[model samples]
Target: MKLKTTLFLLFSILGFSQQNNPASTDSIKKTNIFKLGEVIVTNHQNQETTNRVTSKTMESQNKMEVSRALNLLPGINLTASGSRNESMVTIRGFDLRQVPVYMDGIPVYVPYDGYVDLARFTTFDLAAITVSKGFSSIIYGPNSLGGAINLVSRKPTKKFEFDGSLGLIDTDGQRSNLNIGTNLGKFYVQGGLSYLDRKYYQMSKDFVPMKNEDGKERDNLYRTDQKVSIKIGWTPNKNSEYALGYINQKGEKGNPVYAGSDTQNSLLARPRYWQWPNWDKESIYFISNTHLNDKNNFKTRLYYDKFKNLLISYDDANYTSITKPYAFQSFYDDYTYGANLEYESRFIPKNTLKFAVQFKEDVHRENNAGEPVRRFDDQTITIGLEDIYKVTAKFTVIPGVSYNSRENKQAQDYNSTTKAISDYPNAGKSEALNAQIGLFYQFTELQKLGASVSQKTRFATIKDRYSYRMGTAIPNPDLKPETALNYELNYNVQFFGKLNFQTAIFYSSLTNVILSISNVEPGKSQMQNFGEAEYKGIEAQLSYTPIQKLIITANYTYLERKNITNPAVHFTDVPNTKVIGTVEYAPLEALKLIANTEFNSSRYSTSYGISVPDYTLLNGFVSTKVLKYVSIDAGINNISDRNYSLVEGYPEEGRNFFVTVRFFNSN
Candidate 1:
């Protein structure tokens, strides 16, 4: 449908339904978010640095992937690894390696590189996603240098419940998902399945033909993903619960050839063809909560996660020949197992104390075509303690500390020339002490102020310390852990029950930052921990309900990053400024209309000063109930067909439309 026609019809319906009562927002809040996995402080009190994205918001925005959904929030930026055709995100200037991802409180990042492709994670089976910025709970274990992200699954509150959706995209893409659950008085079971497939995407009309791109449909832009999740829980009593969960994901994608002009100077910047034949992950976990008494409680989590992938590099864009020097096949097999035990007690008056112990082991194996497999193993352990002290009726103070240690047990080096595998030298160990303190004051029933300071650390990943960077880098086995000291202040208030405002300012000082030092050897760079940096940002969010039928929300972020050790270097991926706003109108009890816009400032894409220009995008959607149990949503994204890129050469999709039908039933 044309944009003008769609807008006119929507407004006409709104005018005709003026006499009808406005629909209740509660209708979209049917999903039951799991509470056990939340890492919150001060029991039931909301923190200023924490934000949550609900299933309702995800559905309304048509955010099918985790990375896109997170982009809706302030202080989070969606980034694309164009060369690899992978979607990623950075939180407050911190990459995934510094801020780990978790599913139901269990670590899920890849063991080799400490990164996960957010595009492969679908939102169909999730109830909510929580993000903690700058100041996260120490009980979450180690590696929360910038913050943490947690994916919360759904729980069944009804005897029988089901939710499903099917969608079609203009770019020859299809998506479908199904979720079912049953909740008996003492037992419950939940299961979900989702699939997504896409052939290609069209570029903007304004895009000019490039070396490897023809200005039409993007080449090698195919993807397929399938996921399955299941959970079983038993609540023997009101004070105790245990659950077992499992998830499996399979994905495949083709990488688009580089289309930029900087390929001539750098050997690693050459245009190439690559395809991932298989990208698979599996996880199994068990969680339990038990109340020993009115003043004491215990919680435990045990999990095992596995990852496997195969990459094929072709000689040319045709993807048929592989006889060239760069043509090769690479494979990775990695796995991690972890366990956590937590104990909480309120035995002391006005004080809640918690203690935790965590242990994890990661093993990674990788090999190339006709090469011997090399292996690496690492083990980490953490011990933590925290206390929430109520200084007064309206004031609270939280203090936490943790000791983390990581030991490398084995690292095998492959000598291709001699065809011999030998142990790597200086297989070392590292340890760090993390600490944090937070203070919150309730000015009134509708106003709150908070301040926090934290010191966190992240150990170098196996790839960071061992990989040769395609024969252009040197392995540094003695690399030290990176550390950051973060500070934040925030305020939240509500006015007349119609407007909500939240604002926060954060600053982080980083030391021992891992950077690539050029000319460490004849023509190779080395990863060394000799750099320092600083990151500062401010975020604000506003939500207002002007009338019973209309709601408006907006958020803004301003960030700055500086390389203290070397001002000549630049930070990549994250923008300096971002603004997003949305407007929603409920014309009738069964119909709603939404319009949103996003603005991103220019950002550096390479350390040598390559940048992507800033751009703005508009999107619109309409949702209506067709039946008591079914609803339909139609939307158009990139309404202006603006040509934009998060990276230098990766032009984003142009104008496109999608239609989805969703069904929900509960009893």
Candidate 2:
């Protein structure tokens, strides 16, 4: 009787298991177009696309052109005089200088003048780019009140590969890049080179007014850029890996007209002729990084840079010539050195702890052809600790704090007047402390919620602290640091493995905000902790993949920046609305087509003054593989040739055409 009972129980259990999972007993296999439910370690708790700003994954096409990927992020804008290497990025409500840029854990902003040129590095080597929303993470140190951009480069891989690409745009621009890498025994070596050249391009629009005597408004542009780099890595044992990298880059750019504008002969009014000046920049960088075990790592970087630029103005009234040249050559040299060390500990199974310390020193000097040279030096140190505790399967909390101290030094010498002045009076030291807290909860398998609160600060830059001008509009050597308090909330949900959506709301209260205000013509502006500000906004992103061959992505932002204390004065640096949409289709196994659209609301040309017209841009591309080892991509930009300007004097490119070919070793 006991044997019979055991057999009966076994058979009942088998029948129930099969009933609950019928597919498990079948021989058929199933495939899915959506994998929204799958996530990895690097994926954060804030799943809402609108609640956070992020960089896309590094891939074959984007590796050589990192900015291309950055162009797709929400609420981000780029200002380019002409060259891709001469562009500036602005995000949220801050300028590029306000948002600190870092590479492999080292600050990339030049120390001599504390200015960063985004075009110095090749995007092909990057593994990822992460933007921390409004000082959300203090691990990068002080001076990041607006936010921070961290670029992580590719590490040594086990495979050996070679990749190359060539491209042409419009009638004048051309680009070529190559990458090669291999792993040998316990060491790895990688190298890359890139070259770019472009001639002047004509505007697609008819900017010539019938009554105007001035020449037609052309795109007036010229640019040349080149870069070479090498990296070596060693992994003697399984517990550690070390990498050494070196890179050199140089470029020259020129703009003949008001960069890009329909205005007539505006260049003639300047002291130098309107034949705008040409600019040249060069830089070299070296870095060393180490990965120790799984919980500790460190990185050190050293960089040097030199820049030369000329300014010119045209005055036809002088008649000696259509353009009079008042030449001014400014020379700048800078040295930067920094290090970062990170430690992670998991003493408790359910809790994780992270701590980091960073230090940096910057020395820079500026000189002219006939006059004096000024020098500025600064040093900073920052440290922070963050703890994450998983209270339960449904709840998690994280809290962090950071501190920083900075010191500045200056010196100057005059040659034309045979005089010397101790500008050291403008040098001083400052300190700041910040904190943040965040919480996340999963309500259901397909729904999640999160919130974060943070306080951040930024110090005055070298240009704002010691740059000398004509009069009492003097640089405030005693300027205090800027600070802000920010709050954010986010929500996310997925539907039937077909639609993925996310939304977020954010608000911020800022104090000691810096403003460049002047009372004179050509306004002499200085950095001042002028007043308070309030920012509130909504962000949303929706992505749908209904089938294996089609994907659609769209994002929108409705943000308002205002001065609550002085509502009469508006902060016009950011647009009130922004939208981006993209559709990609895979027609066959090797053919693809993509369409994109970008739109932004009206923006201010001046501080609460002149307003720029709103505009929309359209672009599309088609790609195909002709051979197993080669592919071609063709695209069109500004399909309607819409005329627009991001900066008052700089006109954006119009209706441009481009073609690119890529080759790789199939083996």
Candidate 3:
């Protein structure tokens, strides 16, 4: 399959590359600091870019996972479950529980819902993404105390067009996608659909089914997921525009990859087993994303996301005795509405000032047949002002201040049967005032230096305020918000040569940290306001393209995290060191072949002791343009099929292959 893809791509390139085309805006800004598609980006430039591995869009694929892709950045760690989406992201040694995420400058974070399922998001229509490490994210509120990820969706192009991709996987896996766009007078419409499916994989030579608690053997289950979206935009004139979009997704949940089975201490180890659920989600969004007179920015959006999950499991005692099965049926509804306004202008000849205001509300409700009904409501408002004073042609100073207020409410209702869990306002009405100051200096034509200091806050999430479960999961309503004092230094130097390198270092002190700690008994845990935690790290990135068709890149990160309370317990799940390297060869304009590898060091599972071993994996892919409007590609993951475990008891997929095909209609 890979060979076929390679041949197809070669032919496509031969036919397509021969015809020269106009260069894109991204290509022109390849080396510019504010270029549109440059991977190394400084959204607002917290520091120097030449030394920072700041941004990336196609690290592995055109679509990259926030956790997996961001981990390549210096001081960033992604704690995930076999790349299946339920993972958490941590930066600069801070816990995933503290980091926040944004979309197009809007705070898309849920006040109390710490889980930002990255699996549900796609980068199909994104212009660029910015990842602010350490104190760099102070400009954004709330979760920015730990750092932040900003996903910027692309706007409609001036001309109508279409683009898409297709592929297949080895051993009964296949995928395909299609996208189309058109502009009729003042109205624009776009629609897209994608389908993906993978069969169960065998991890080892003795790949026998695992026995369940009841001693019944269980088979590995893969997935078949589908996504569809349609969007429409209307522009009365240059002054206003509105967009409406709907996204729907449905798929099988993934079972935790497992390591081994303990026949004697089966009970303790069994709790670590994983099972995929039967679930689905659908959402609708409306946005008035328009610029006022091209100088002022304004946006208003509303969205609702609905999900249904069917969880199946058996009791521990069901091993020796036969018992009826239990199923947890749950439905989740999320509604969000928000607006933002911003203005940028130069009040003084060489001085620039920017002011912005934002408001957002989120409501989530979860209902289960036998469990208590859960409701979460949260709202936030923020006002900010910043001034950039150009001290001289070679230097600038930026000073900014922001005031934000947040309110969250959680309620659990009961009607007999099971007792209602505690309902507490863990995060009351809280408000914070943060301030930041940054200085940028151009040392020479080839060197730039930047430094910044800031104060930031992270509010308690809904899960911390009102979460309850048995064995290893307990909610603490008394958990307090997290705060941080951060410092950063960036250095970027460019020499008159073919080689380019970037480096950045950051440090932060976090107080009132929020974390999940295991209790005395197994399968029991609680979330609380732990004491201070310190995280510091540095990142280095190097890239060189000998020619337009060949590119090589390498990245490395080193991070350290410690709990101020004990100082001995190393933060869990975060790896101390990570490295990635990639090589791409584009022999023909339409043909691209890439080889990539990732390395992760040993990591802890719990603060007390249990840890996972370090491992490295190699993967490769070849993509080809089969025709003017179609393309094909194939790749292999876990090439060696190493039997390794990321999370306890959960084993990862062994060697696997996938193929995809794409179709586009521009006319």
Cα lDDT tens digits for candidate 1, 1-667: 3334533533333332223243332343554776676777755333332388888989988999999999999999999999889899999999999989999999999999898899999999998888888788887899999999999999877776667777788858888788888899899998998888889998899998887788788899999999999999999989899999999999999988776666633423567799998999999999999989999999999999999999999998899978999899999999999999999999999999999999999999999989989999999999999999999999999999999999999999988889999999856779999999999999998898899999999999998899998999999989899999999999899999999899899999999999999999999999999899999999999999989999999999999999999999999999999999999999898999999999999999998898999999999999999866668899999999999999988889999999987766655
True lDDT of residue 7, candidate 1: 36
lDDT of 2: 0.61
- Listed per model in order, the count of residue pairs whose N, CA or C atoms clash below 3 Å is 0, 8, 28
lDDT of 2 by residue, 150-256 (tens): 66554434245445567776777777766666667578777777777667654547343222113233433566667776777776766445666666666665444
Best-to-worst ranking by TM-score:
1, 2, 3
Q: lDDT: which is higher, 2 or 3?
A: 2
Ranking by lDDT: 1, 2, 3
Q: Residue 412 lDDT in model 1? A: 94
The per-residue C-alpha lDDT of model 1 at residue 234 equals 93
| Candidate 2 residue spans exceeding 4 A from truth | 1-42, 45-68, 79-86, 112-115, 119-122, 156-158, 206-220, 237-239, 259-268, 271-326, 413-418, 443-446, 469-472, 520-525, 564-570
Clashing pairs in 1: none
**Model 1: residues with Cα > 4 Å off, grouped in runs:** 1-31, 43-50, 263-269
The local distance difference test score of each candidate is 0.88, 0.61, 0.60
Model 1: how far residue 342 lies from native, Å: 0.6
